[model samples]
Target: MGKRSMPEVPQTSGPHVPVLLDEVIAALSPLAGKRIVDGTFGAGGYSRALLADGAEVIAIDRDPSVLPFAEALDQEFPGQFSFVAGTFSELDDLSAGRGKIDSVVLDIGVSSMQLDEADRGFSFMRDGPLDMRMGAIGQSAADLVNTLETEALANLLYAFGEERKSRRIAQFIVAAREVAPIVTTLELARIIEKSIGRKPGDAHPATRSFQALRIAVNAEFDQLVEGLFAAERLLEEGGTLAVISFHSLEDRIVKRFFDPAKGGPAQSRHLPQVETAARRWEKIAKAIKPGSEELARNPRARSSILRSGTRTVADARPTSFEGLGMPMVRGT
Candidate 1:
């Protein structure tokens, strides 16, 4: 598993430099004959790198717009690459018949390509439809903004976005929607800005609220917990599980999955260690943040962390969503 300069992963896609590329490649240590699953294919960055390393890759992404990228990878790698258009939570089923997967890599959260395309409505920097549904299958962000109760909306912002001014923002949303529907990104962005005034150098006032809406509309936290469990069941003994998360919430779930104590306080010597399920992962890396060089080149990698582990011979056990530090949004 020698490190090599990665080739550019390009398509008609937008600015998407895969975060922690060298670290991820080093963590998985892809071999020529090994099979790996790129659970969040995004713009095919990971899959292309793995394919270039000569590993057989199966990529999964729920966004149908990534089909062009997938098609290009499939063509470039031929037999060594395959694409699956489905959610990563059901990755095991989506990747069925790919025998004895040797590794699975998940890059959690929204893709840069999705954010760059204003039509997809993932970013407030540009005005687009208020839709943030990843696969065109569920309620749009506009649906939630237009219909969810103020309390529920506030809970959503507080839970998912970690926004301190959730109630005020939610109140503004309700009051504005009463005048008319909040049907566009700018419309909602204006409400948030009006409720929470902007500072001279701070980020846009709508950043947290938009992040919360995207998570709620797509159920990202739940999807992440399930995907972790699915990877547990999907990997064979000694397989690698590598995850790159851009936020604390996603990183916490990855940490708890690798840690035996669920990242709780250390057990005191005075008390006997309580019996827990047999260890499922042997961690090789924990909370490895981007280097200054990487951050300087790609500022989007600033908040990202890479955590990886090797699968053990033990059996996989049940996963608890709430136990993993995932916030429950009270039916938002």
Candidate 2:
């Protein structure tokens, strides 16, 4: 069968707009003729920008649903873009023998497309099935909500979402599910809302719990830690690594990876000075947040943060999860 052309994606409303785009491009200066990687490739926003700047882009996404979007990019850019339907953790192998990569960019957390599509079950805005797998295959949110013991569920919420009322919410869910399975996104949202009363104008009570479940379903943190190592291995000397993370947990992981002083095995202030080995990254910049103008244009950009660093000529070190400081969640 002949391959059919994909219709151009219409400009849509909501948080789909890439946040802090100009800042990201500036950080990745001298884009022309560079080979770069866009690890998330959500909606192809960053990839489009890179191609426009005369870069050869290798873009990846775990979600098969993004194939159409990527196909559109292929049609527009021809030889300038290549899309890989896989996680970024394998980026080293994906780019192997392709020669040196100039830069790598990762946008962490759920994309606006996922959240906006009710059928995808990422948001509680409109009731949908309790499934939050980034890719088509995996345990669904319903599976976790229905099966995990009350204590285990509570721990997951507390560890991942930092929800203080995790115990109460977990108790409520367990009791409710005993009657019948917690099947839909709203069903669980209601259970959480009832357990933790919401006040006027407060964020949805289900927000944190949903986030925790989505993270677990996608194994987001594990992928993130591995992706960091993969990027380090694929980048050439003086290559740039930029990460835009939306929440505190994601930001902390990036911070720990880039700045040894903030994360990982901490050095003792009292101990005598010892020479350090060649580091994988240098020139870590302060975290950059969206400006007022950006926030006004896109309210969703308020919580977005960008952190970046330049790769050094040193050999990539063994990956470490210790520096990320994530509380251990069993069976994630």
Which residue pairs clash in candidate 2?
A: none
TM-score of each: 0.96, 0.93
Candidate with the greatest lDDT versus the true structure = 1
Q: Taking the tens digit of each residue's C-alpha lDDT, what string does model 2 give over 1-332? A: 22222223545423477878888888897899999999998888788878887999999999887787788889999999999879998888887777679999999989888888887888988789999988979799999999999989998998888888999999999999999999898888999999999999989998999989998888888899999999998887899999999899889888888876666355688998666667778888899998897788778788899999999988898887875776677555
Error of 1 at 208 (Å): 0.8
* Candidate 1 whole-model C-alpha lDDT, 0 to 1: 0.88
Worst 10 residues of 1 by lDDT: 1-10
lDDT of 1 by residue, 177-277 (tens): 99999999988898899998999999899999999999988999889999999999899789999999988878888898788576767778899986776
How much is 166 displaced in model 1, in angstroms?
A: 0.3
